[model samples]
Target: MLELRKINKSFGSRKIITDLDLQIEQGSILCIVGPSGGGKTTILRMLAGLESIDSGEVLLSGQPFDPTNLKEQEQVVGVVFQDFQLFPHLNVFENITLAPKLSLKQDKAVYTKNAEELAQRLGLANLLNHYPYQLSGGQKQRVAIARAMAMNPKVLAYDEPTSALDPGLSQQVADLILEMKQAGMTQIVVTHDLDFAKRIADQLYQVTPVE
Candidate 1:
């Protein structure tokens, strides 16, 4: 399980999250919803080790997790940023396999095989050669998701998952999230879309900005 205990965060004089706690079990989906700038993305970043916590503890299973430890953190948490953060310089396949290729140091054929399977599952098999700019918003999101899944981490986090897509495409993303959870992947999502949160989340957290 992933748990945050009495977490506090501040940027300069402005506080974001204070005395906040969350828990997500393996194979469950946790969606966090709130108003804009309510620190939802900050929470996701802190969970992914992209941001530091001011105080409190982040634990994986029952052990403490150190945000300063990149190598250990990457082994457990994978994040899909709100903007879909795909590499502009690399094609889809390259983007998806980049981390695994570097970390696993396996033969090209091995990671390529795994990437192909993941792309097929995420409906991106046909777009392997396409660049991010060449694809639509929804396609880029799927590519981002595939890239994250390729890491095979214990936890997956998405920030504002449906913000950039049309309503139709947003539903597709919701379905994809549910499919991933049903396949036994733990997920943590931050979004303002309550309906989308209802569709996929096993647990939902409401966050209010600390005044």
Candidate 2:
């Protein structure tokens, strides 16, 4: 389980998240939805170790979670950005395996096997040699997901996952998220689409901007 206790965050003089509390069960999908500037993405960033919280505690499985610890954070959580940030120069296979190679320093064979499995599961096996520029939006999204899964993190978070997709693609993403849950992966999604949230969320959180 992941728990946030009275979390607070700010930027300069403005408050972003104030006294926020949340809980996510293992192998469950949590969807965060709210208006713009409400700190939904900020919450995901904190979980992904990309943002710092000003106060309170983040705990995973009853232990404190430190966002500042890069190695620990990378092993515990992964994030898929809204823009699907795949490298233009790297082919799909390279992009998926890069993090494990750089961060974990795993042997080439181990990472290769993991990458291939993730690609096959995500339906990107046939496009392993293709660059980001050559792929469609949904394919790029899958590649991003495959890359994150390669790290073997227990928790995965996404920011605005369906913002650029058509309804069919959005449903595909919903199905994939469900499949991940069945595979024992916890997921947190920050999105503006209420319908999408309703379709996949095991629990829903609404973030309101701090005054």
Candidate 3:
């Protein structure tokens, strides 16, 4: 469903990705395991159009990646960063519903029903009105997942998804991920957690060490 052909990106004199090439299948989970600063997040940013590719291309299905037209990419991908970028002031209901409500611009009642359904699936039904500060680390991360699901994305990219959580909570997140896997969500996760990766990924690509 996605292809990265000789995709290269750099910051001035330092190159992070050099002739990196990959093809990801639909409905498969992939793990990208490597050292810090090994161009993992750079790959995600490039795919998400948060950062530009220096050379080569990232194609969704068969078309080239376009930075300007996000609406064109809406149904194709989603992502979860390590920091769990939830809005601090917004309640969980607001944070989770923000993207879909803004992008889809559906009626409040319809969006609310959709948001509530996702929240319930992710075990956040009772916490919708709670703010970020009111949630535990796991709660925040689940809210992040629910937010992504709210967008109805088919391809999900998870960057070190469980890195900041404690052992118990990390496993909780992994369990949630596994549920998604069983439901046929295509995911690419960049993580150092081998056991967790093995539990979820259908394939593994160890990012090569940079010289």
Best by lDDT: 2
Give Cα distance to truth, residue 72, candidate 1, Å: 6.8
Candidate 3, residue 125: the lDDT equals 95
lDDT string, candidate 1, 1-211, tens digits: 9999999999999999989988899899999999987999998888877789999998988999776576732667788888998989999999999988888675799889999999899888899999999999999998998888887788989999888888788888888888988899999999998988998889999987666
Ranked candidates, highest lDDT first: 2, 1, 3
| Over 4 Å off, model 1 | none
* lDDT tens digits by residue: candidate 3, 1-211: 7888988888889888989888888878888888777877778777777788888977877888664347742756688878989999999999988887888776899889999998888899999999999999889988988888888886888889888788877778778888888888888898877888888778888776556
Q: Candidate 1 — which pairs collide?
A: none
Screening candidate 2 with a backbone cut-off below 3 angstroms (N, C-alpha, C), the clashing residue pairs are none
Candidate 3 TM-score, true structure as reference: 0.92
- Worst-scoring 10-residue span by lDDT in model 2: 67-76
Task: List per-prediction Cα lDDT, in the order shown.
Answer: 0.88, 0.90, 0.83
Q: How many residue pairs clash in each candidate?
A: 0, 0, 0
